[model samples]
Target: MPELALKKETGLKKETRSEELLQLVVFQLGEEEFGLDIMQVQEIIRIPEITRIPHSPDYVKGVINLRGKIITVINLDTRFGMEQKVHDDNSRIIVAEVDENVVGMVVDSVSEVLRLPLSTVEPVPEIISTKINANYLKGVGKLEDRMLILLDITKVIMEDAPSKVAYC
Candidate 1:
């Protein structure tokens, strides 16, 4: 019957929509775990020699030459107003595209790539207590035993652009 066929189609659509997944490249900054959309990330590399720019913001770690391309690096800990930690062997640079610019972020370590269903992601909480500004968060991803702070990379990179002309 037409009604039965229509019901089956609608059920299939709902099932597919509910199963949609968001892939993220998770990384650690200080004591918190953060997730960035995998599509935005270019690559992950070990820390290299960075050329410090004079008089730059404290969050700017410097710049690095990546295969003949100059990429600016940001220290997430300092940017989030967290205590700075020494980089060790686990330290890594996450190269990502933000607002048409290729930039790198220094994180304590790179964690596993996560694939979370859309149903698990919740909007930013009103009382969420995080050192990082709420404007930089996309949402909070809830897992069985843990949670991930999803980051809006564009906001993270351009938060001060209006006031900081040097960063533009």
Candidate 2:
């Protein structure tokens, strides 16, 4: 019957779509674990010598010359309203490309690459902390005992980041 054929086609389409999985680059920010789309990340590099820019935003740590290309580096901890700590051996800069901008995000450390089903991700709740700009979140992904907070790279870099400098 036509109905049976249509149902089979629809089921096939659903299976095809469901097969697409999200690949995340996991990292640690203080005690919390966060993830970003691996496709958005160009590469991860050690904390290089950063040249501070005059009159730059508080969250903007400065610019770094990676290999030969200069890239703007943002302090993720400060941007999230977390306490600023001195960079250590574990510190790393995740070079991310969102839209036309290629910037380095300084995180405490890099963890691992996670591949999970898209269905496991859930949108953030209405009640969230003001410290972190919730509008920039993709969702929280549940995987066994791990709860990963997925951040929207575009929104976080383009929208939530403070444009003004913080006067010390």
Candidate 3:
């Protein structure tokens, strides 16, 4: 419910425009396409300096004081077990609120927000013969050779990772 509330706060194009389908904020994580429920995103900020917290989880990049509110930041790349990349010009922070907790995830350049019909949203593929974790994906959105990995943001952040991340 909070996620839905967050989406409402985003002031994304009205659902009526998409015929009641949820709007998806698409972005790039490495070479893959990822989508987030537009409502969950609070803001898109250019990547900022993240102070690493000693003894914290490897995926936890650090914390940021956003308008006086301390928010934990996560490196989605590390969380997803991908190679960590230095934040650059094309990098961004997608601030999303989940269950009242707002966290920022580092990502490659953001693409665009598109309307994804719920009917077109299918379950994630069962083959981890693939490159990503199925639990993090809600489904795939097909678009003329490009497939957007529809993300279940809460699941991606809240669920136990498929494997433990080795701390550097």
- Winning candidate number (lDDT): 1
For residues 1-168, write the lDDT of model 2, one tens digit per residue.
999999999999999777868999999998889999999999999998999998777789998888888788989998889998799999999999877678899999998998978988889888876588887788999999989899997887778443432221
Error of 3 at 154 (Å): 1.0
Clashing pairs in 3: 6-39, 7-39
Candidate 1 residue-wise lDDT, 1-168, digit = tens: 999999999999999877989999999987788999999999999999999888778888988999999888999999899999999999999999887788899999998998999899999999967778999999999999999999998898887872331242
Candidate 1, after superposition: displacement of residue 113 in Å?
A: 0.8
The number of clashing residue pairs in each candidate reads 0, 0, 2
Candidate 2 runs further than 4 Å off: 1-18, 160-168
Candidate 3: C-alpha lDDT: 0.78
Deviation (Å) of 52 in candidate 1: 0.5
Q: Among these predicted structures, which one has the highest TM-score? A: 1
For each candidate, the alpha-carbon lDDT, in order, equals 0.89, 0.86, 0.78
Who is ahead in lDDT, 1 or 2? 1
lDDT of 3 by residue, 103-135 (tens): 888898898888877766667767646545777
Candidate 2 at residue 53, lDDT?
Answer: 91
TM-score of each: 0.87, 0.84, 0.79
- Write down the RMSD of all candidates, one decimal each: 3.4, 4.7, 10.1
Residue 1 miss distance in model 2 (angstroms): 24
